[model samples]
Target: MATNAEIAGRFEEFADLLEADDVEYKPRAYRRAAEHVRGHPRPIADYVDDGDREAIEDIDGVGEAIADKIVEYVETGEIEELEELRAELPIDIADITRIEGVGPKTAGKLYRELGIETLDDLEEAAEAGEVQEVKGFGPKTEQNILENLEFAREVGQRQLLGEARPLADDVLAFLESVEAVERCEVAGSIRRWQETIGDVDVLVATEDGEAVIDAFRGWDSVDDEIESGPEKASVRVGEIRVDLRVVVPEEFGSALQYFTGSKDHNVSLRNYAIDRGMKLNEYGAFDVSNVEDEVAGQRVGERVAGETEAGMYEALGLEWIPPELRTDRGEIEAAANGELPDLLTREDVRGDLHSHTEWSDGNNTIEEMVDGAAAMGYDYYAVADHAEGPGIVGGMGLSDTEILEQVEQIREVDAASDIAVFAGIEANVDAEGEIDLSDEVIDALDVIVASTHSALDQDAETATDRLVRAIENPAIDVLGHPSGRLLNERSGLDFDATALGRAAAEHDTALEVNSNPRRLDLWGSAVQAAVEAGAPIAINTDAHQPSTLEYMRWGVHTARRGWAEADDVINTWELEKIREFLH
Candidate 1:
């Protein structure tokens, strides 16, 4: 059966193809329906299988036409219209649109003009100076396409954290069910919570390595067994590669430390170990101060630490560093000096400032969103739906009148509910960094999250200026998704963080660490820079649906990676303190 993600993917592809074909209206409808389907709480396929087409159509933005397609996909495992459209265009629409400045319209234009159907074809055209000869194409545009081709290729090789993390969880669950498995952990970049992952790595502590390997190879999700050994195996699951390694229980800690490295961190540690007359490897740390033969193997000397990660670190005269801070970014020195930060955790988040409801592009209504927030134990919640401006799609942004009207509705809900509901707007910051909303509307609101929705390709200086102007606005309390980047998709902006952070500090505006897995903007390094510059950070999920609020964990880990403490994040403050800061 097709999952919500699979069905949503089809609708999104349908929208992309329609847009490329120059078909209007329906594309927006399909895209909106796709978003609704992806965020729907239940399995859409279940509705289709039960012959409940009405139930499926009842979904927000899903019409009879989209309902019929959903049914077709669920029952027949394919949508005929989408297949026909693919046949008509016969190009990699996804790959082509992924280029920085290229959209569906541009892809369609290039295909129609130069018969370009893939990245390879587009690259060939750009290299031959044929793109500039085409109408509306110029030297600068051609250069951008060429420059971004490599990034696009790299993007194709990696999967978004949101998509890959669930698969990792499933793999871990399956491995843990094996009788021979005593301990299991996910390692590498996934463990570090990097926004994009190349593959899933699993390490196991078990005496029966062969039994563990056998059990892993027989799992139902294994699409193909790439390679298998007595102690190790690799399998392809869906579009991701999963590797499993097993060692004896004693060596589990050392093995995990060895595998969960950022290469640079491990290199520094190895040198540190050599300086201490010790050898470190996956097996254990060995004291070799008196050993005459250097190449006598790791087990040739007295064992110091191997049973636990902390023990290994203690053996080296350092504290155990958090996984997120294990990036060789002074974490070693900090650990040695006992000065590693007490990184922020999920519990530190008090409320979410950026969210939406049916009044804008969200699936739920105001009452439902408020109820969800109350259930999450938040003291306050802000409904910062999109305001009328650029990139406000599906006519979903609220006008000044609508925002005023929403303020009344929000007050009514706040009076009736246990949790405080703050009326707010996610006002769009234009290319000039000026908000389109009136000062009156901005001041009347409890919070204003200014974000850049369009003009993402501006050069560094212009982008910095635009953002600094937004920060300087007295009405703007937080800068949402400062860089506007989408993981593995778009490099939204490239401004100097130190400059922007300093300006933000001067203006008393908080920088947002958007928790939406796709846009963990103000990523780790940027968060650190902003915090170092004395600018407060706000970790917001930018949730369009209630369930997405759970993504706060990802944002917290990302912030921790940046070395942010609870006090450095404004959201972690009490409701009164938050309101005081806003005022």
Candidate 2:
């Protein structure tokens, strides 16, 4: 059976092909299906083998045709349609399309017209005086392609948040050091803590926009300058392009509103502004009733965006929306109705349900991990070092006997520490759908988080069955990172979240939203699916080191993306409630 990655990859290729063909809505459909399949907790082959396409069709935007394709790929070990598309076009689609202005269609056209099938081919064509010879091509366009092709290949795709965040922080720090940059913030999906990031967008509020732009271009890390303007500057830091927008202090808030966006969310906000007799753009909010440029008799050609984020919201007659809640979810409606869920706050977390110490591969010691949790004002902490099973070849996992011995040590620490230290094991759910720890050891721990650590090759049915079996176990308190996904590296287990969620609800198992930036598993969509099925969630750090404990910010932000509230999460509960719920 083809892995989810393999199937998802082919779909992306098809989507890219359709995009090259300038196919519209269908690309979105295919892309959405690819995301759904890629994130689905079950193997695609199981549904195919069982002749149940309903599971695939049940995905949010997947329909019969896409579901059929998924099944066909599973049954035949290849997608014939994709093969046909490949044979027809047979261009090195991804590589050639990486050039800045080149889309799939442009790539296809260039390939068909100039026989430019590779980056090298395109380069050769550009160098050999072939590209400028094409119908709509020019010298500038060729130069731009030559300039961007290497970058496109180097960046490969959008950087995951894990990879881009440090660079953003460094830039933020550097910008703040600039005298002209009075205030600065990352304004984009990065601020929203989305799992994936395209370009790093930093918005600066400055008294002197030109000075700020000049300072940005000179940023130490900037390797190449893409474009420099009075208001905005784009630079390449390594392979990632960082866009810096400098706005006067007065227009800062408005610029932030314009830049910190999921475009769909911005579109909704802009319409909201329009309905209120105000026009919102990067410059500032304006009243355009009497002007052709959409701003007349109001703050046209003036700056007033940075007075306050609240002021911007006040103009729109809505509450200041938190960046995490900026997705075009229920926030707009909730803000309108004054019914926004009191979101889960960092302070609401009573304990870390999934953590590691020296007993496994974690960097911190047990005493230090407990002390850190206590220092953070947590009422309790569970040391969930890995348990031996399929994935543990040597030192990474604790044996059943070792885990039981650690339970005694946990009791010793619990007796001494001011905070409660719960003994738990991050037990591996083997390919055969069973957790490695024996019932006796499971009964001894205060919490048990069963997770997939091996046999990731299993078909979705097998993976889902494995996880569901563990979820059905009476001792398993939480299911860690439900999808086993590692950002930019691996996608998690292929379990049917709806089905597993139902099972979790029946068995009272919490699904973990791992906060580690690299993982961010049980993503917002999965959390929503689980919540819809009445399954409780646990926002955990899955912290390997003390510093990683702060990863909860990303997790909490991610959970809010799923519309998770205090009531939906176990960590958001008080310590007594947490213990009672687990008990």
For this target, which candidate reaches the highest lDDT against the unseen true structure? 1
Per-residue alpha-carbon lDDT of candidate 2 for residues 262-357, written as tens digits (9 for 90 to 100): 665777788887786677776677665555764344366333343566677767778888777776655777787777667777777778899999
Number of colliding residue pairs in model 2 = 16
Please list all clashing residue pairs in model 1, or write none if there are none. none
Where is model 1 more than 4 Å wrong at Cα?
1-155
RMSD of 1: 18.6
Give candidate 2 regions above 4 Å deviation: 1-89, 99-109, 123-155, 248-250, 268-317, 458-462
Q: Name the top TM-score candidate.
A: 2
Tell me how far the alpha carbon of residue 568 in candidate 2 is from the true structure, in angstroms, after superposition. Answer: 2.8
Model 1: weakest 10-residue lDDT segment is: 35-44
Candidate 1 matches the true fold with a TM-score of 0.74
Per-model lDDT: 0.86, 0.80
Per-residue lDDT of model 1, residues 1-583, tens digit only: 5666578889888888888889998887787777667545455777776888888988867888889989999889999999999898887988998776688888988998999999999999999999998899898889878977876776664787777888999999998899999999999889888878878999999999999999999999998676788888988787777989999999999999999986657777888888998888899889988888646776868899988888888899999988888766678999999999988888878898999999999899999998888877888899999999987878989999999999889999999989879998999999999998876787679999999988988765678889999999888999999878787677687676777789889999999999999998887767877888999899988988899888787889889988999999998999999989984
How high is each candidate's TM-score? 0.74, 0.82
